[model samples]
Target: MKRTLVFGDIHGGLKALIQLLEKIDYSKNDRFIFLGDYVDGWSESKQLIDFLIELSQKQECIFIKGNHDAWCQEWLENDVVNDIWFLHGGKSTIESYKGIDSSHKEKHLEFFNEMKDYFVDENNNLFIHAGFSSMHGPEKEHYKTNYSWDRTLWEMALTMDERIQKDSLLYPKRLLLFNEIYIGHTPTLHYNVEIPMQGCNVWNIDTGAGFYGKLSCIDIESKEFWQSDVLQTLYPNEKGRNK
Candidate 1:
């Protein structure tokens, strides 16, 4: 059977991302869902985008847009970097493209423009870069950007008591709308775990590849996973967002 693999925020850690793919021995039969924030934090934002563009030609790939990606998109379109974006990780991305030609810049911008806010599979599995509004389902048609920026969904799962997992009524209906929900953005490392985390039906796979944690990928069907070494180990010269 074909496998579906999901990846968390890369934050521009090209080396780690490449290593993680190698560790998984990714095959063309695999369908990959990337949870976004592909650029920023690390120095290889440009290279990361290039890699993904190439990978998409080789396999099925789904790209979700993260807030960082939004900021990057804005910078690409208007050439005005948001102050907060610069503070967060945009500075490195800008530096990475210093002296780079415009044609490649356009390619990266186009990739960012085409990213989706979320993806729902035939099995009703929701894959997103961040949480979605629990009050409004993903199908709701207003301020759709919230699908990639909301944190309440994950926050609810993170705070939910383990004993309540089986209580259908206790869980929010929006979360129950899907068989499984995978998200990035909030790093599992903050929860003191470097591995993918499961809370209720939600899985937080952002193992903090932007910081001290590793980049993570997991098979949605088998729950098997692979992770790269620490971000510091892969990009020893760069401080990334950990600074």
Candidate 2:
């Protein structure tokens, strides 16, 4: 059966990604929507991006840009690394690129540059790396970076009174604008839930692979999901957020 799957933050956990695909029995018919931050945390950052570049050639994918992706793109294009980013996995990312061909790096840079900040499918489901600030919708967002940084959208949904009916005026305008909103920047594990989290119509899929949690993917239609082993187990030698 054809399935449209939404993936959460990779955080450079290439092994987890590969393992997740095998577990899902992924096939060409399976559609993938990756919420970014593909590089960082783990030791295979460059390799992970390279694999994704090749995968896109064989399958349908919607790549949403995350804040980490933005930082990686800049590093690729300008050879500059952000001090803050280095402390939070950027050092590992740069290390992964060592000895990689410059030409190969360029292709990865192009892939990052072309990623979308947000995607709306035929069903009007919204796929974004983070959240948007505009109540009018992402199209009218005051700041595009908010697509990969805003937490207000998810926060509103998370804190909404469960008692409020969807039709009630008390409902948030933003939540009413889309059939559903999917995001990844904030890991669901933050709340101590290790699975995909639902807050109203918003879904948080980042299960925290960047740290000790597992990488996750959810079937947008059926809500069935899959996860990799805790990243620490997959890369015992690496400090995938043990720091």
Clash list (residue pairs), candidate 2: none
> What is candidate 2's local distance difference test score?
0.92
- Compare the candidates by TM-score and give the number of the best one: 2
Candidate 1 residue runs with Cα over 4 Å from true position: 165-168
Per-residue lDDT over 1-243 for candidate 2, one digit per residue giving the tens place of the 0 to 100 score? 888899999999999999999999888998999998998899999989888988899999989999998988888888888898889889999999999887887778789889998999989999999999888999999888899999999999999999999889898999999999999999888899899999999999999999999999999999999999999999998888557
Model 2 stretches astray by more than 4 angstroms? none
List per-prediction Cα lDDT, in the order shown.
0.89, 0.92
Residue-pair clash count for candidate 1: 0
Report backbone clashes per prediction: 0, 0
lDDT of 1 by residue, 114-152 (tens): 899889999999998887674567778366777778888
Model number with the top lDDT: 2
Q: Provide the TM-score for each candidate, comma-separated.
A: 0.95, 0.98
